[model samples]
Target chain A: MLVHHLYSGGKDSSLAAWILTRLGYEVKLVTVSFGLLDNWRFARETAERLGFEHQVLYLPREVLEKAAEIAIEDGRPNNAIQFIHEKALEALASLPEVGRVSDGTRRDDRVPLLDLSKARSLEDRFGVAYIRPLLGLGYKTIRELTERLFIVEIRESEELEKADYEVELRHIMREKGLDPLEIFPKRHYQSRVLGWREKGI
Target chain B: MLVHHLYSGGKDSSLAAWILTRLGYEVKLVTVSFGLLDNWRFARETAERLGFEHQVLYLPREVLEKAAEIAIEDGRPNNAIQFIHEKALEALASLPEVGRVSDGTRRDDRVPLLDLSKARSLEDRFGVAYIRPLLGLGYKTIRELTERLFIVEIRESEELEKADYEVELRHIMREKGLDPLEIFPKRHYQSRVLGWREKGI
Candidate 1:
């Protein structure tokens, strides 16, 4: 069985991929780019370090434009990221080779979250299985698992070089002269995976 | 890391244990009994077949009594089962050797479901992590996975011998001369795990 995991070179998605691999599924780490920036290369690099097959799929530039508009109008990023996340998942699920799709969305995630109804609808529409291994793990548990399983670098959200939609969305926000820092919450930390932790370390 | 998974000898929980085991956690399959019946032995049999360590934990009989009262008063089993599920999780988390807990609850399950707030509260109070591997999987995906991994026996709910709290709770309902059929939905199916599937089968 093959599982496509949305990759952002981040702790949560990396751990999710590791779990699927352990569970006897071949995992393909995929990063979606909006064609606005080359940050998707970060995820590709992490995938290379993790020794998994990696690919970057492109979504239309307008998708990020609409998401940025939503963020600027709402003065927040939750709905905007969630919107792009759905589109990305749809694009992944529509692929002929993709039968199972997963993401790093956790039980405590506010943005890029997929509720049960939407999840079921996605599965029904795409004929794909949506798996979220971290859905039941809370914030503290995820931190513990990531620390035990991976080498990660944590920094402020803006300082982190990652492949998530926020990077591209923020780029558009800047083009509109709206500072993303004003919209996104302060003190947010983002983690980028460096490599796997050795056993007995 | 050790995770104590609430075992019912059913497909959902058995699959959860399999996932935790594959993820490098030492899983102890624990079946909680209200001391009403010996059905927990069914779980012990499956655990033995899977070659995992298993135990039977006894809860207070009064807990079932209260749950039965709630079921009879409300004419439904969702709230009653949820109440007992919370108590069972608390008991599991309270074990000194236990640092993490998990269950078979799925995304679409109405009864015995733990919402985010309660799950977090359980973790905070017990200083343990709660993991639900099946939390994001819907009915179709669960059925597909169980079929691929386990040889299961499917039958009417009442015909299935299981270790879940419902078995004992229904016993209490019968003692009250209440037909559990009235409280539980008709035409429900339950599955018991026979064993694991071969690698190529």
Candidate 2:
């Protein structure tokens, strides 16, 4: 019954680990470091603080170098989602004991379900079980729970605001005034959508 | 050489149609009508004014009825990107001409490349070609061209603010401080993304 909390010492991952621990799951915190020693030390330290078996895996430095290029592709480049999945898989591969890979996945994140795809994909690709305790809960709830649990602030995820990549794309299309989501695709399928304000049904 | 400008009668698609016609593509405009005759009539009239052969294809109606129900799950939900893709595919399927489907796709819209996967799947499944002519242009430039060409304007697309599902999803997530694009991708793939602030990378 080795349950691994893919911990990055962040709020969501740490809190998820905390929840599973309270549930009597034998928890191991999995942190992957990409040459950031401070982060590496903090994640390892936090895992120990939580009284869980802890392990640190170093990510290949190339991943960080490549992230920006992946982030700013002009045409249909695989977004951050794909890169994150690959990196997680790599980390999982290097772990000592991984029964089920759990983490600080929450509804507050983009396409909350997107993780399920990545996890399922990882499971299929690597034969690992990926579980998320915080799937349906929204941002407000996640924030509340994090505070209630006294978990470390969920702050690893940093959105580049104002005239950044997303904003840059928005600028190009916003005045043309398209829905950023339509072009970017929040929905992955092509289904007949109802609730539309169509003139005549 | 029947080139159907898959017109939403909106800026991007209309602009795309405008370009290919000037390139001597012998373009014919096709507007897929689902859920609204008045809207289609309006779109159709715009196509006619462009002096191009216009064809209107109606969706099966049931698809529209199910989009919202399909977007959500037991209080959890998917995003709008899925519905748009589903609708786009439905429209693409009914294209009568055996050539290819063309639309107002531009360089910026090329990121997730929804059309990439969709076109591949459609071509593999049905051998339909999905072509985007404004491949390299940005919205600012497209707007300038639309003015130059005197393209008919559809205020509904503008007033509707385009990507209704996405805007709604953004509104839903924003109340809780969610990233709109991530929420929107719920429809396409459920790949979890980890964000880094302050070299959170």
Candidate 3:
């Protein structure tokens, strides 16, 4: 079996991919770029270290910005993040060999969650199974697994600017004279995987 | 500093007690019994294994039943559980050596949660600090820590009839011809810690 995994190079996504590999599936890591200021090099490096086949798909900046505008208009980032997430799933599901798509979404994830309605729609429209192997796992479990699997370097989301598309969207919103706090709450802890030491390296 | 810890002999409470001990507090494990079908022998055994000073406080069945009735009337178990939990805190706060009270409530716990208002009142009225070290730690972390610290046996909430006070309360309500299901939702996961392997055993 082959699974197309949405890779963000973060602990959750990496763990999700690792789980797929453990489940006897060949995982093709798919990273969606929203044409932000991101180079997505960290994700590429993680895929290399983990020794997986990887691909990067690009989405138009206008599409992402439009989604962000809708979220900002509604005074929330949830809708915007969900929109981008749905788009990424759609893109991954479009792959020819991808009969199944997976992500590292845990039970506790809020913003990037794919609602049941969207998931049902994807399964119906694309005939692709959506899987979240880490759905019931918690932050501590993910961190524990990551620590054991890879020698990882963690950086705050702000420090790893390109890791999250929201950073670019927030920057764009700021340029438009809109306060980012109005759309997104503060003190949310998000981290990016900078690089990793191979096991025993 | 001596802390009174509300214990239930479950993984969460045991882990909470373990955390408090590590943090250098003199932990007095306090288990509240609602005069139900429980002697709380499991809690006593756990306290003994963990080497903590243990106390079992009794709350009148009428008091607990009344709270359940109110919650049934309100169509929610959250309020009823919180009421019982607050009463437990109030009782523990009255102890002279107890400058602080803590619980094993985790981030994902719904019922028996201390709302902001109740927490504030506890602090303002009793001048006792209410702490939940497991507040932000999720289910996985608690279980992992429990597994690491002690050899544990887990039993389902239904299987361990006397472990949770809610079971007896539900029985009482059932006797009153009120369907407990209407008040308390089904498939709630609660557990009893049967025994733990000694450090060297």
Candidate 4:
């Protein structure tokens, strides 16, 4: 069975990838780049190291806004994070070679707000299975598996900004005692902002 | 400031109590028993050891059901989790001496979902500031603090279940195994259902 583990290059995402691989599932890694994640490269590298084809689905402005709106309120910052998976499900279902999309959804995610069937149904609109492995495990368990596997270089949320994940932090704290840039150091890697200028939200 | 740190003898709640204490706040730990939490004694003991005024909030059936109907999803389990907090918050606010309510709301909790201004507005139509000291800190930091401070006994989420936390594991096998107790285990923990012949659920 092909488990397209949602490989976000974070600890939980990578751990899910590792567990599914050990289970002998055909594992693939997928990342949804908000076009500004601080850990984009780490996510990409980990997926590559895991021997999975890494794909960065650009999160459009509208999608990020919707997801962030929920995340901020839900305290589960990726409240609609699985929407990224939904998009990936849509992308892969169109491809003749791939019939399934999988992810690394966890059990103790405060709430299992994401429904894979939502992705599956959205994909079934195109007739494909959206799959997820390690969905039943907690984040603590995911952390244990990641450490046990000895694959640790992961990204932080701050890595999302292209100019510097510090872009907004700097802008907001220009007059404060601490430089926002110093507080939140910039990430080395970068990604294209497809929707930034036109939408300007 | 009187930080009424909400401690449910749970890690996040207790750690929140400790963090504020370290920052020079006079912390009074509050533990609410909604009745179904089977290990109320253990929680009481932990609170006593920590030397905080541990208070147990009684969850009346009508109030819990009112809160539950609003917070829980119709088909899915565990929606009662948020309402449980709502009930706890109401009880916490009713204390005569409490000026401001503080909590163990950590980086991990959906603080926006539990915003006291929102809860208070809907709840008693009164205002209380709900403060979280470790709002932006990571779980690992909290784990480290829990150990370093000996704030309370470090227990997993299993402690909250009227049944064992592992019950979710078994329940998962029977159900879709999609969510861990569908969020929080739906224990009849002191919901006026357990001791007698009448159907509580």
TM-score of each: 0.94, 0.37, 0.49, 0.38
Each predicted complex: what DockQ? 0.71, 0.01, 0.03, 0.02
TM-scores of chain A across the candidates, in order, are 0.93, 0.63, 0.84, 0.59
Please give, for residues B69-166, the per-residue lDDT of candidate 1 as tens digits: 99889998889999999999999899898889999898988878887888889999999989998897777667777888898878877633778888
What fraction of the true Cα-Cα contacts (under 8 Å, chains A to B) does candidate 2 also have?
0.00
For candidate 2, the docking band is incorrect
Error of 4 at A40 (Å): 32
Local accuracy of candidate 1 as per-residue lDDT tens digits, A9-64: 88889888887776677889899998878999899998888888999989999999
Residue-wise C-alpha lDDT for candidate 3, range B1-201, written one tens digit per residue = 677889877778877776665444678888888766665666787778767778888877777888878777899777777788888889788777767788887656777877556765776688777767565444444554566567665445563444455666676777788888888778745555555544411
lDDT of 4 by residue, A57-171 (tens): 5545555455544444454423344454455456655666665555555544533334433543555586555434344333333443445454343334343432211232233
Q: Could you tell me which 10 consecutive residues in candidate 1 chain B have the lowest summed lDDT? A: B192-201
Give lDDT tens digits, candidate 3, residues A64-173.
Answer: 78877887788988888778888888877887877788887765577687655666677668877676666533444455556756655544445344455566668778
Error of 3 at B122 (Å): 1.6
> Which parts of model 2 are misplaced by more than 4 Å?
A1-201, B71-78, B94-96, B110-115, B151-201
Compared with the true structure, all predictions reach lDDT values of 0.86, 0.48, 0.70, 0.47
**For model 3, what is the error of residue A128's alpha carbon versus the real structure, in angstroms, after optimal superposition?**
24
**Candidate 1 iRMSD, 1 decimal:** 1.4
Error of 2 at A151 (Å): 68
List model 2 lDDT by residue over A1-201, tens digit each: 466666655566665665554333577776655543334555566556556677765567566445434544533324643464467654784455654666565533442234434544556666555556454233433454455454333333222211112323333344445444554544332211111121110
Candidate 1 lDDT at A13 equals 90
